[model samples]
Target: MNDIGTILGNEQFARKQASFGPGGNVVPIPRAKKNRQPPHSDTDRANVLPLPSTNIPHRTQSGLIPAHVRVLLIQKNTEDRHACRNALQQTSDFNVELVEAGNGGEGLHLACQDAFDCILLDCSLPDMDCLEFLGRLTELTSGLQLPLLKLVPPHKPELAIEAVRRGIHEFLIKDEDGHYLKLLPVLIQRMLDNRRLAHEKQQIETLYRTLIEHIPAITYIASLQISHQWLYVSPQIESMGYDRETWLSNPDLRFQCILEQDRTMVERAFAKSCETGELFHCEYRALGRHGKLHWFVDEARIIRNHSGQAMFFQGVIRDITDLKSMRDELETHRYFLDQHVQSRTEQLEKRIVILESCNTELCNQLEREYLVCNELRKANNLQATMLQAIGAAGVTVEESFIHPET
Candidate 1:
């Protein structure tokens, strides 16, 4: 009975229990604190527990599957650092590239320069306190979730507790015999998986917020429930002289502000959007708090569920009062301009006909003038011929009398 009890509660069994994790097949270590004995001498190695057999590490986190994980090991001790590097590199599942930083200051400097997949920070750094370094590292990340693991000495469980209180994801205790190094890769894998999921979620939220804020319009999510409740309204509600909180939970405020003449049209359009799960654009006038009629345009679409059912209406509403006024004024100017152009065209047509008549009379008068000038030229030519003939005959008669006397 003594032999059986001793075998069941041996150091080998304790080691096995201590190494078990939630993911590993081995049984987990109990939460109750227990005294740890000094390392056994080599002569007792005949009864030492064999290391757990693992073909490939179960290091994968929930959402991430990295081909190579970058690990920055900040350890002042050379032997411990070497053990950690070897364990990480020997992992068969994924490649680990180990980087060493001797002190906390250097670690902080290194951390700020590049984005690492996992950081193995020593809880007792030489240059600065490990807690300070952690805080500074967190500040530098600017709320970014990077997989960081703190390396604590096995003797100081209080430090580990404090790190946990300060929101450190996980911590490690360096084992002098290098047995603890084997667990590093699995811990890193788990951290990375957790970080990936957190990052993806934050990314989605940021994208949605940025998209809604940049639209320069009121982004809305309307519920189809009683009074057509509003689920959300963007900060642009200030443009309508209303607070964001008041309109977010209330539905009738906006409708009450709509001009009585335009309420039915807007309501019908809103109803159609709720029914069809299709948000259409529409323009309507609403009375402002100052008793001025403002024009607005609503454009939206419906959010549907997997069952092809309408869940809610999501869309943007914009103020188009200036545009509407400009369009109406342009139409008025166009109408007046059209009438002015028609009247001017008629008057110009009448003047053109009178000018055409004057042109015809001038043409006839010019033709008569051209004919009279031709007749005058003929008369002048005939007179000139008569004068020449008279002169020539007088000269001929004188010559004949001179010749008869001879």
Candidate 2:
């Protein structure tokens, strides 16, 4: 087999030999001078013929070439070879390389060697039928991230459909006017764009998975209107007694998993939130797979579309059963303390009233005793005054009698 370098070298040698003669008899051809146009001039337009309007809807002037695209052309016809070259050259933006393979076997060999941006597969080859080629190609590129475009004859539309079913990106039919070549550039651009988009999507999915794995709370996205189906659930749902498949398969099963008493309140709050497009927050008990009940406080907000219609809800659920139990205990203690304080206050007031009544009776008794003592002292003084008067009068009479007798 001739390598590319050897083939190019041989072609250059043949061209040089054809230009000379054995007896020094040579044809003189003038070398054309290279044209140097002004920098402001439209130089590319001068170098290449413009593609027909039907072929390229718009001309690109951005001068940005997408990253190099590897193309595998598996057509055996010479016309197809020329047409493909013309199409690639007209693109002016894609770096397209042609790897010509005569049969599907050879094509599959090339496809397995390296990753390609797009594979332009000729459906009919001399050695293999289109179906066999597609089947083998499917197996070859099954795990690959590349896109494939199959080429087929115009009469067989059925093959195109089958090709699509086999995971081919798109199919093109070779026509008489070579219009199929025009579609190649557009197809190439689209494939590259799709590849870039696929890469970005994969990256986003990876980031989402990583975030869901490490986050502490249970996170999910659920539909707002249709059965409240869970579109996505974090890995934490497994710890909460539900897997992603189980949740997605039956959304109402989640309500059944909730404790019967809390189910009604949770459903009511959820419905209100969906209707009002407000934040939903509620504490509910979830029945685990083991029949143990765990409390969770769900906090979610409704997501709305551009027309202000509720689309879905996204949020987190936190375990708060312990906190709730503690709160109830604290409330009970507070109630007991309040009752005890109130009873003690009533008892103290009654004792104060009884002490006041006893003090008033003691004051009345002391007043009576003081009045009786004053009366007794007055009577004793009166008796003493009367006795003194009587004694003085007796002494005066005795003194008179003694004087008469003498």
Candidate 3:
């Protein structure tokens, strides 16, 4: 419901919509004869609609439009500059600030400010060649994406093709009646949108790199081939005493770092996982810089395609030297505990055997004593019978009890 001002603040917006008249040409509209309204303040200019085109730029869900899109118009022809300005002035929605430069030198100078979002470069410049200017601009914004729309004369379509071949972002054909001016805003908006998208993509990539670089482990992507070509390796690889470039360039460098004793085991485990599309996991000792042996736990999963064919490996290697030290220390303690318990068990078993032997010896001695007492009792009974027989014969028995000790 925002009222974007009509063209020139006098004509109705619908009047600017012209149809094809005769021989497939846009019909010209007559200007309204009404007195123009006074210039609007800055606040009113903020809501002006962009130049009308089939593709109208929509405001984002935040209901916010770009503050202003600064354009560097590099054209020496005063009439062309006036035409471009008049076309731009048609809208008030997204403010289009145009800065005119009569020659390539001034344009390049203005471009150095790095303030403009897009550039309108004329193929024919009075002072310098457009290509040379573009080259210098490229140098100025080496890692940046700036949209440059080249304006080509309708007669010299070859210039547009040449500029495109020479790396111009986009090109527009100029006609005598200035019909191409109608499409100017659309092309500029498209280029601006593309530039915005490129900026966002670069920011996302930077954020991803920052996260990867600061992590505790080395993350990598490797090809599934036997050579195991590395696609990407995190900057954390430097902690392992190898630079990222060295690790990525030389596929065998990782294996070379592994200790001779553990190299075969790690290789076999990795190969098996790669062949079977299984998870790869192995712990091995590797020689770091200055012959420092460190333990590392490497784990990876086989990334497969939709057809179940292995594609590559996405993996992480953690420096487990400290963790391995603690684990080995615990194992040593456990081994000593086991040894101590075994020795204690053997000692207890020996003591039990000796006690059993002593108990058997005591049982035998008690049985022998019982037999001797029984014999003595039998002897006493015999002596008593003899005494009774002697009493019948009037013979006295004296001290007839036989003692076994005697």
Candidate 4:
């Protein structure tokens, strides 16, 4: 099959009718200069129309050329329908099976009978206003996404403009030689590619929303201003006894919910983060339904614009009431245990002082007893020495007492 450059060249050379301006007047075609770029190769033609740049998932089933496409061709004239069919057959990149309809009623009927990958609409269908037909078609297939490409006559650029205003996906001008028909395959491919991109984006958004809504924490986006106006809050906010709508609607409700004692701490942290463009983190207590106080760990960061100016805040709030209670309980236990240990240590210190005093008194008594023992030994030795002297002197007191003792 011929590529896009060959097709464009064929269309240009085959043109027989003069172009028309917005006033419906003839515009003379300029003759091509001899200085022209050489014909583009297949690779160059491929480069002329590349896929849009995006991070969406790869299109395995739908790419530059879909595998099989069912197109609804709505043109009243049989000759024009046949020409469109012939043009669609010129390409080898993909296969298109046409379902032809003579008028808008027949086209809508055929659309209801089955599904179509795209719709080829001619702006000049008989028996119906084109806009009315479009409105009816939209109503009938409200759930179905039908991408329509309108074919407008060269003299009726107003019709093309009006069709665009009415949300026509794409349009082409008709000509005498019907060379404009050759663009059908390329246009259809581009329209489908765009549709696929839109579908991928929507799917990604839905997946992310599901994940955020079901998680155990509440996610939020808010303004960085002191008022802290809420931009978005996840459905999980309901777990904290506040509805999502209420949290979003009331700008001051978030601050009001915070415990009075912790409001300053939260505000200070938020201010510091906004000034420095740093992470805002703080633990605070908030009043829930029925005046119940819950502890929360709020973590947020300043979202900045390209120039590094703070734009807004994105954050997550986790209910840490259970964790906070456990920590407080542990602290209380530690405090009491410390007091008990301190009391026991003081008692032990007093006992040690008393025992030291008793030990000193016992040591002094032992020294005095040692001195008395030394004196007693000296006295006994002296007495023994005197008795020895008395025996040597032959003592007369005992002999004088023994005369009357018989």
Q: Which model scores highest in lDDT?
A: 4
Q: Give the better candidate number (2 or 3) by lDDT.
A: 3
Tens-digit lDDT string for candidate 4 (1-406) = 1111111100001212332222221111222345643654676444332212223333234345456677778888988887887777765556677778788788777666566678899989986977777888878866355678888887878888888877777887776656566567767877777776666666666677788778889888888777888888888778768887777888988889998999999989988988888899999999986688789999999887899777779899999988888999999999999999999999999999999999999999999999999999999999999999999667666676776565
User: Please, what are the lDDT tens digits per residue for candidate 3 over residues 36-150?
Assistant: 4465577544443332234555433221325456677889888888888877665444567677878887777666653666789998998888878777887875634467898
Runs off by more than 4 Å, candidate 2: 1-65, 224-226, 307-309, 325-406
**What would the TM-scores of all predictions be?**
0.48, 0.65, 0.65, 0.69
Q: Which stretches of candidate 1 lie over 4 Å from their true place?
A: 1-203, 326-351, 392-406
State how far residue 323 of model 2 sits from its true place (Å): 3.7
By TM-score rank, best first, the candidates go 4, 3, 2, 1
TM-score result, candidate 3: 0.65
Cα lDDT tens digits for candidate 2, 119-234: 78887787888778777766876645356777777777788788777777667776665667766877767655656556666666667768766887888888766588877777
Residue 92 lDDT, candidate 1, scale 0-100: 57
Decide which is better by TM-score, 1 or 4: 4
Clashes of 4: 0
What lDDT is reached at residue 154 by model 1?
A: 69
Q: 1 or 3, which is superior by lDDT?
A: 3
User: Candidate 3: worst 10 consecutive residues by lDDT?
Assistant: 1-10
Task: List the global CA lDDT of all models.
Answer: 0.69, 0.68, 0.72, 0.74
Checking candidate 4 for backbone clashes, the offending pairs are none
